[model samples]
Target: MEHITSTPTAKAPAERFTGDVYLNMIEAPASPAHLASALVRFTPGARTNWHSHANGQILYITDGVGLVGTRDGNVVRVSAGQIVKCPPGEEHWHGGTDTTLMAHIAMVVGDAEGDGTTWLEPVTAEQYAHALSSQGGS
Candidate 1:
């Protein structure tokens, strides 16, 4: 058991998200175990694009409000201390609520090679709008 070498925090790329987002990788398999965690912060109205994971992922809200949506037509509003899970290969997205900042600790189940996650397309404005409207917008 040893402390993993921390990597520099990086901006989440537009390819994987819309608006401004930052990520701080906390632990990775290379750092020690099968655990992989990152502190993800989203600016107001910022969120991830539609994507899926090979081994699934877990997200624990840490600050502000988070909006999580799935391909199954479910959209959830999660607050600090709340936790959400995405099943393997299920397309989903999560990010800050409109007009609010949001943050969460994201953990992806690692593969044998230590790489996990298969990111897909960015969620369109139409989709986001539909989600909010369906949920009655908080």
Candidate 2:
């Protein structure tokens, strides 16, 4: 097995996020292993744009609180140690809450040729407001 070195941290672009976010890639898909992983950290009120994956994504929350939302108005409030799963081709967005910081290790199942994410429009304040006000979890 070949050892993988640590990658430098990268700032998440504004075009794809609402606030400050950072990413530290843990692994990139290598031949025979088409899975990629990264540690993603988000500042308060920061989140990803609506997106989907070809083979789905898995997230293990590492710290603080956050929300995972879908276009269908299903919003899940998540905290440290939780795991959130997004199925293939299901558009969703995730990020920190209005008053909390959140960090998670995101693993995407796909090849290295691309980031494996199909990004769309950013989440608007109205969407975020509804998320914050909604009572998630049964």
Candidate 3:
């Protein structure tokens, strides 16, 4: 068995994230064949921008609560022990809710090169407002 080197924590881009967010590489293909995972953390009000992947992506919530948005105007609220998936090429974004710190294991599947993670625009205030309204602001 080979050992995987640990990398220092990287800062999330201000253009994409709103609050303190961090991630750590867990298992990579080099360490375990065909396996890759990341431990992600999002502070209150932190979230990702609209984006899509060529293959797909999965989010396994590990703590607090999280939220996800789809292009078709669907906002899903997820909590610990919940799992969320985004199909290939489906524009969406995920992150912490308004007043909670969210964390999850994000698994990016398929090709590492053309795997496709196209980052789109950030979640606008209007979009967030609409999402909250749709969910009764819960």
Candidate 4:
């Protein structure tokens, strides 16, 4: 057994995030392990871009309130102690709400096909507005 050390927290890239988001690497799929995870924190109104995983993704909320949305324009509000699952190859985005900070442990599985996430364009203002509407602005 190995005692895992903490990795540096990094700001989510502008090309892949709409606002300030930070992530700390929890695991990175070492030998014999195909699983990787990160502890991600989002500032109020911050969110991720359109992206997908070849093997899906799992998010375990750890703090504050957030929202997860899909390409279909559906948005779901999530809070601490909640879980959000993204199906394989399904494009989606997630982040903090307009007035709440949010954090989650994001986990994913890797295969020989690719790394884990395929990032696309950032989520637009209109889309975020729709998300807020879906959440009733609360």
Q: Which 10-residue window of candidate 3 scores lowest in summed lDDT?
A: 27-36
Count of backbone collisions within predicted model 2:
0
| Cα lDDT computed for each candidate against the true fold | 0.86, 0.91, 0.79, 0.90
lDDT per residue (tens digit) for residues 12-48 in model 2:
8899999999999897777777888999999999999
Tell me how candidate 3 scores on lDDT.
0.79
lDDT of 1 by residue, 3-51 (tens): 7677788998888899999999887756445778899999988999888
- Model 2: weakest 10-residue lDDT segment is 129-138
Better of 1 and 2 by TM-score: 2
Task: State the local distance difference test value for candidate 4.
Answer: 0.90
Candidate 3 similarity to native, TM-score: 0.84
Question: What is the Å distance of residue 132 in model 1 from its true position?
Answer: 1.6
For candidate 3, list the clashing residue pairs, or say none: none
Model 4, stretches more than 4 Å misplaced?
Answer: none
Higher-ranked by TM-score: 3 or 4: 4
Top candidate, metric TM-score? 4
lDDT of 1 at 124: 85
**At residue 128, what lDDT does model 3 achieve?**
70
| Ranked candidates (TM-score, high to low) | 4, 2, 1, 3
Better of 2 and 3 by lDDT: 2
For candidate 3, write residues 50-105 as lDDT tens digits. 88877778999999987888999888888999999888889998887777788999
